[model samples]
Target: MQRKGPDRRALETPRAAGLAGVVFALLLAATIVLMRLGIPEGVEAVGAGGFTDSARRDAVRAALALIPFAGIFFLWFLGAVRAHVGDVEDRFLATVLLGSGLVFTATMFGAAAAATAVLAVAHPAGSAPSLTAWDFGRHLAYTLMTDYAMRMAAVFVSSMSVIGKRMGVLPRWLTAVGAVTALLLLFVSSNVPWAELVFPAWSLLLSAHILLVSGRRRRVTLT
Candidate 1:
């Protein structure tokens, strides 16, 4: 009986994951920035009396439009990474990773929905939402994004870091960066504006590393 060598398709998994991850990172970061600009926090958020400006409303709409694509690419990245890791993955950590990623995506969608509610306040079309409606919608959206979704992102980052450490796939520096990112998401993101950006930044770094590693491997295989 003859056993075949590893399938060439398998080698492409890391590349796919890398590309997906890069796209997800960029999209998510842009969405977050737009959302924040559209729905600013603090007393000024209420002071401004909310979305009187059509441009801000449009920015929120753009952010909402980007959310679905960001989530899709994130899922693709998640599945590809899992496929790349394959049978060597620890069951418990894998479960944690999958669970957190799913939760994060759902939370992001919830935030987008809340933001959409704010946009719909165009009751007669071009009319600003009542202050109360604006406040509630903005609060709900930020809460879901920073408090819930970012926490889930933290869980995903930390768990991936642990797995990478055990598997020796990620470099020590990258794992360290992941640890910092998780901590920031868990503790700082909810309180500090723009802190959630770390998650996407970390994702971009990880994706770049994966692409570099996979490219080297493919080159070596060819040689």
Candidate 2:
């Protein structure tokens, strides 16, 4: 009987996916930070003249520009994760992962659109947005991001952690961290200013793990 060599393509796919996940995590974290700094949560100040500041407006524009790229990379990350999971994935958990990820992306985009709307309405220098418009846009953007998108992200994280635990792909501590991240996103994100950052933190750790595992497998295959 002749021995077959390792499949190079199969070995490379996980590595590529891991890189994409890392990029996606960095992009998302940057986007969140920029948006938060640009749009401070103050109903009265924002309604008055806070947005008229050039620096804040520019920060918001920068954040808006990064959003599409973040979303693009996120889709790539999602696809890579699915590929890594392969055919052995549980249908119910896989469905939850896919659905929640998609929803999170869409909801994130919608939140960006709401923020853009605030900018659009604020155009024409020396003119501040009406209280009603400012309040609506601000609340809508935050609600979509913190309320809807974060919750969907929680589901995605929880499902992925469950799948990884069952498949023995993730360490016990990593899975435990994912569970804690999901709980924070689900219950604390809306109330805490920076709680949503946990999602990206979890993503970065997972991506780094994936990359490490892929590197090890590649070395073993090449030897």
**What is candidate 1's local distance difference test score?**
0.91
Q: lDDT, candidate 2, residue 140?
A: 91
The 0-to-1 C-alpha lDDT of every candidate, in the order given, reads: 0.91, 0.87
lDDT of 2 at 92: 88
lDDT score for residue 115 of model 1: 92
Backbone-clash count (model 2):
0
Regions more than 4 Å wrong, model 1: 1-5
- The sequence of per-residue lDDT tens digits that candidate 2 reaches over residues 32-147 is 89888877785534554788877778888998998888888878888888877857787888889999999999999999999998888786864777878878888899999999
Deviation in angstroms for 71 in model 2?
Answer: 0.9
> TM-score of model 1 relative to the true fold?
0.96
Instruction: Please write out the lDDT profile of model 1 over residues 63-98, one tens digit for every residue.
Output: 999999999999999999988875798799999999
Residue 113's lDDT in candidate 2: 98
Return the lDDT, model 1, position 107. 97
Candidate 2, superposed: residue stretches over 4 Å from native: 1-6, 43-46
* 207 Cα displacement, candidate 2 (Å): 0.4
lDDT of 2: 0.87
